[model samples]
Target: MQSKTPISDPTLLQLPLDTRTLTIGGLAIKIYGLGAHSASTPLTCIHLLHPRQQTHEYMTGIARSLLHTYGTQALICASFDSRNHGARTTSPLANESWKGGNATHAEDMFSVYHGTVEDLRMVVEYLGVYLRRVVRHFVVGVSLGGHAAYLALALPRVEGVVSVIGCPDFVRLMAARAEGCGVDVRGVFGGAGLGPIVGRLDPAAVGMVGLREVWRGKRLLALSGGADGLVPYACSQPFLDEVKKAVWRGELELDLEDIVYEGVRHECTSEMVREIVRWFAACFEDMDGGSLKSSLAL
Candidate 1:
């Protein structure tokens, strides 16, 4: 693979794990993604979480392309089924909220975070131990996967985080959805003793409160499409605003470019993909003071 252009390789590798089942807090979960790592890799590891209800192949391919384009070779990409979205149907709350639980949706989300962070932690630990490599690990996610990425970053292993088209205000979105369904959102989280819990687990709230402390001096990037409707471009704005006025203030920058390809929705676009690749490439490539190009390798 040359540094001049990104690789067009579609070949992906699947790990030879005995089992993909992960048990956390008495809750079982499944992971359906790639675990690709070559011998003698570097420390800057990448953990990519896919969108809701997406396959591992799709997510891993995107991650691989991003890594290849960025010239960041020290990376390992992994994607998993959060709950009842994929091959984890045996688990409770598959494709639905927790049944008869006091907090319902909030509890479900909590379970997801608890389970997901643990899975990611295990992967990082395994790579560090078994692979005998990796020092600086970063996480990137999109949509619901973006929230999971934040959760993983909150864990011990993750060093930095990149959230793409993810809404940090989980409670707010659920509340709006509840209203759309004619259900009282406040009653759901509040009545179920989830309001405070949500305050504790909400990504936006967490980012505002202690994320800076946890990720102090760490590079964080919030990427989103300007015309995104599903996750809303507004979601990333408030956090950027809060961080600008906060304790961990530094050269933190947020990229707000929207790829306007036809029929491109909340999903990843070729331009967006190429931009990510170029950004990664710029990080490692010797630029020789030349202006970086604004494009993707579609």
Candidate 2:
């Protein structure tokens, strides 16, 4: 918790990247990647977000690690800027993309979540054209970016998701903040209730609550801090409970894994990052030749 600086994986820095700019409806996207090993391997995109409270350089090392590990014949790992974060901040957010984040801190945070998810959507679509032979996509996001990862799973193109210190139930999150932190519910986010907007965007509504097929097929790994005072575990506990219930009934094709660092706060530890890299890498290693390959874009 003392450092917001991302620990550099020295070896990762040595890897070369294929950097380029792609226009998403007049918005210039700056993205960099490292691999496309072959026709058999498709890219697995990782979307990252840097909210106001966090360090801007937070995801760089993680991106590098991913590129080093899966950017081979196994996947194509890439990172793009969300609106107002990196290269796209000057591009504009109100005109055509998301208009959600311009208010208060919490409102802006949620807006960033919405905008970044859409940014990732555009990036994924662009990648489909840029890397045509690629397979399925996987997303790993932290904090606000974590929200984007959950939302991305709703897309048919995305088969896997990793959400760290993020919440999907916007209503519950607000409720928790109101109760735990004593914020006004009705005026919690910029004096406008967040319930309605969250309802439309919450991943819980899409994956759980009986979207049986998507729930069974999509692979999800949720990481949280047991002592997270920011976005308390109760905010996501209900959704986690639902995922478990579904998996318990013999409905899941892949495991829905959730890990909480007992005393850790709302932050990612070094071990958590390593586990994320390993877990994502494990996705394709089983190589039944059919499951992973078929999971990619065929």
**Best model per TM-score:** 2
Error of 2 at 13 (Å): 4.7
In candidate 1, the residue pairs with backbone N, CA or C atoms under 3 Å apart (3 or more residues apart, or in different chains) clash, namely 70-280, 70-281, 84-94
Q: 1-298 in candidate 2: lDDT tens per residue?
A: 3345343366666767566556666666545463345544555556555433343366666766666666444544555556566544652333221223322445655677787778677766666676555546678777666767777767666777888888877767766665644455577534456656765677675565545654446678888889988778878989888778767887655567898889878787666677788787567764434455354443
The TM-score between candidate 2 and the true structure equals: 0.79
Model 1, poorest ten-residue lDDT window?
Answer: 289-298
Runs in model 2 with CA error above 4 Å?
Answer: 1-21, 28-30, 35-41, 51-56, 87-106, 180-182, 187-193, 205-207, 251-254, 286-288, 292-298
lDDT agreement with native, every candidate: 0.52, 0.64
Worst 10 residues of 2 by lDDT: 94-103
Give the Å shift of residue 120 in candidate 1: 1.1
Residue 246, model 2: lDDT of 68
